[model samples]
Target chain A: MTAFDPARFTRLDQYGHGGRLGIRYHAKAEDWVELALPYAADQVGDPSTGVLASGPIVTLMDMATSMAVWTRRGVFAPHATLDLRVDYCRPATPGETVIGRGECYRLARAVAFVRGIAYHRDPADPIAHVAGTFMLMDAPAKQARA
Target chain B: MTPPPYAALLGIAIEAEGDGPPVLLLPFGEPVLGRPGFVHGGAIAGLLEMAAIAALDQALQAEGGGRIKPITVTVDYMRGGRERPTRGVGTVTRLGTRIANVEAVAWQDDRARPIAAARLNYLIERP
Candidate 1:
């Protein structure tokens, strides 16, 4: 089993309500994190249209990727996203919770690569896919203490 | 009628008015961040899309003109964006009867080192 840390996951209080994003940490995997995007944020636009706004999906993937890195490293490393590429496969239905699992595929001294997918019920039918790289920095000594 | 939802939400201001190509700007703000202190990639895409669409809007207006809608866009993020005002410059790649292509880049600090770059394809509604 992989080591897991609780501190890496963002709590409910940290998220905005309605579309409040939630993260669930798996005890068995240190580098794997699951993100839940509630219906409020995920189901914007029209239900019949089946067109979820790309904004919320992007936000979810971005947060998930960052969390995956944070979990593996065991601390919140100061980082900036160098690039994020998202491809929309299908629109996620409103009123459905979309789950995203992100993994840090590779990490260099200063750069980290991440990839993940968002799906509603079937992983085989993904709603969106994302690939991104983040530039990491050593935590400031002061922040590291707290 | 109100302006397009995206234009209003993004606060993009039209700088020059014409059919050749339109120019717009996205004011930098904290709300556009991915991390606590970094600009969000989605926000960058939004900015790039706006700039591309605005350029197409200008071209259509110039032709006296056509309706423009987005087909697809791809962005390559280069560097981290600083917490300062940035500008996006867009140029038309092709303006045909039914399709328009545009390229744009967002820069802060120096234009030579852009924070992000993108290419956009738009479907034009010809009159």
Candidate 2:
């Protein structure tokens, strides 16, 4: 097992769904990771309002939480999402990049508790909030690489 | 009604039948993949939300027309989605003047066995 590296992670794969959506690593710490999703025409839920869909924001948070689990463990291990709850506070401003910050608050043997928020320049005024859990694989060999 | 651009990005289409809610179809491809062989959780969630909105839109249209705005959603994953086309549909349980509650489910191959389910709340702006 090795420490999770966001820079290397992006350079390795460029064809996954996340990559196609332009989700990139913004910042990270010991127990949390922040990812960025740039607003694009393809992500618009409403052509009238030009607001990004709730789905893309969900994707951003999922990836951020997945990476946060690895960062908490200090290794890139395999895991699966068990459940997730997302609350949309408001519509994201069109053309503004949405930043999602995921934090692994608790890590047990088989599960990791995670929470996150999506915002623009200020996290205090978040556009969305999420809480979820990931089920850890028993052995590293059983990892799914998500 | 035509789906938005985000629906196309997820490879989703509305399958309307006789007097029933529309079913959303998500085909397996590079745009929906996670890891290598499995579908991404977020993609599945996206599909569910789309289905929910479609169902709620139908309900609201009957009463006159209104704007649908998402409030919250909770998704529960039961199984890993394989490399296959997934189907999702939403059922609006309650439609009030200001709020609506919808339930959505995503399944592959068999409807009885769902890969994931979601509960969503929306705020409606009446016209």
Candidate 3:
């Protein structure tokens, strides 16, 4: 089996799909990390109103929270988001970038807990907030694959 | 104390408030609703979070204003929201110095049946 490498999934290469999706790793801590989403296709809206869509925001929350857990485990653990909840405080501006800071609060045997806040420039006013749980799946055994 | 700037960006309006919980009102528009005519679950989640935050803010204010961060939020979809204006309400279950628990229900026309229900836990950070 190939060894687990966290560097294989850097924010720039993993999240950079092109045109719309753009993610950058701003900082990292012992068990936490901050990600910035400059823009994404899912976040576009009416050009006149400049309202950011919510789909990208949801996707961002899912990915960011998952990354937080991945960073703490220090290995690539295949997992799926069982459930996610996001609160929209307000619509994001069209030109402004949204930042998500996620932290893994607890890691159980099979489940991990994560929470984060999405803001643009002002923390007092968050664009969106999210919290959810992920079900950790152990990497497939090498022998099992063959 | 006023509504956060982000609230304005999302166009959230707090219609009413009471001692227990606060009511938040958001207009359903094409950009927000995921489907052509149906409201997206993500949008509903967003609304639930906003209501929960409002409730948390109120609880903290009463307790002398401190730092509060979200811990976990679980959303249950009960029904599909139509492409119209919807209302949301959040109530506090447990308010402590360290943690605050809240439950919120959102619906459009029928108050008895909720389109979505959510429970959230907030970790309080004292200032």
Candidate 4:
């Protein structure tokens, strides 16, 4: 397996679901990755309150955890989400960019355990917390070039 | 409850279901794609959450209107969402003055074979 390249990773698939949600690379380390979801009117859950929807935040964490998996493994491989659980502690401050940071706590041969928090202004007072796992699909056979 | 931003992003539409809470229909599109051909898990989660909210809203309207605040949600992905219309309906397991528990399932083709299921807990603020 080759080392994970942040530059290439961000550029390769820039128009997937995560990208469409306005999720962008924020920062990353050896075993963790952070992504940001900018507040948008169309993403608001409640217009009166101008609060962002849970889906965007969940997507942010999903992408963050996925990137973290690649970061920890030092490579990118196809994986599927098994399950995800989220706890909304506080409503994310409206009009603020939500930052999602995910860490790969345990990486088994077939599964990876991840936990993350979403926040806008204060990390301590996060908007939501998430815990999930991804199933690593076995390496696939070589694909034919189009 | 109104459709959230994510719903619009995914083009999820509300279809009337026999005068009850509307059913959520997620049209297959680029924004909902995952992997190569399947619907993204996040998109499905978004639909489930919306369905839950819609159901809760209807329930609240019945027992006196109230504000809904999401507290927690657990989503289980059972199968990949194919390139077809996906529908989801939420059921309120218990509606109380303070807390409400809801469950939702999204499926395509056969309603029995759900692509995903979600359980949500919301904090209600009675008017």
lDDT of each: 0.64, 0.88, 0.67, 0.84
* Docking verdict class for candidate 2: high
Best-fitting candidate, scored by TM-score: 2
Q: Is candidate 3 or candidate 4 better by lDDT?
A: 4
**Candidate 2 C-alpha RMSD relative to the actual structure:** 3.0
User: Which is the leading candidate under DockQ?
Assistant: 2
Stretches of candidate 1 exceeding 4 Å from the true structure: A1-31, A38-50, A94-98, A139-146, B1-7, B56-73, B92-102, B109-112, B120-127
TM-score of each: 0.68, 0.94, 0.53, 0.93
- Per-residue lDDT, model 2, residue B67, is 89
Question: On residues A10-126, what C-alpha lDDT tens digit does candidate 1 reach at each position?
Answer: 353253221233334322245566677765532242233444445456667776787788767767667777677676676677568788777788866677789888888887898
* Candidate 4 local Cα displacement, residue B26, angstroms: 0.4
Question: lDDT of candidate 1 vs native?
Answer: 0.64
Candidate 3 falls in which docking quality class?
incorrect
Off by over 4 Å in 3: A1-146
Question: What lDDT is obtained when candidate 4 is compared to the true structure?
Answer: 0.84
Candidates, ranked, lDDT: 2, 4, 3, 1
**Model 4, backbone clash pairs (residues 3+ apart or across chains), number:** 1
Question: Pairs clashing in candidate 2?
Answer: none
Clashing pairs in 4: A42-B5
In model 4, what lDDT does residue A9 have?
A: 68
Clash number for candidate 2: 0
Off by over 4 Å in 2: A11-13, A139-146
Model 3 chain B: weakest 10-residue lDDT segment is: B1-10
- The local lDDT score (0 to 100) that residue B33 gets in candidate 2 is 84
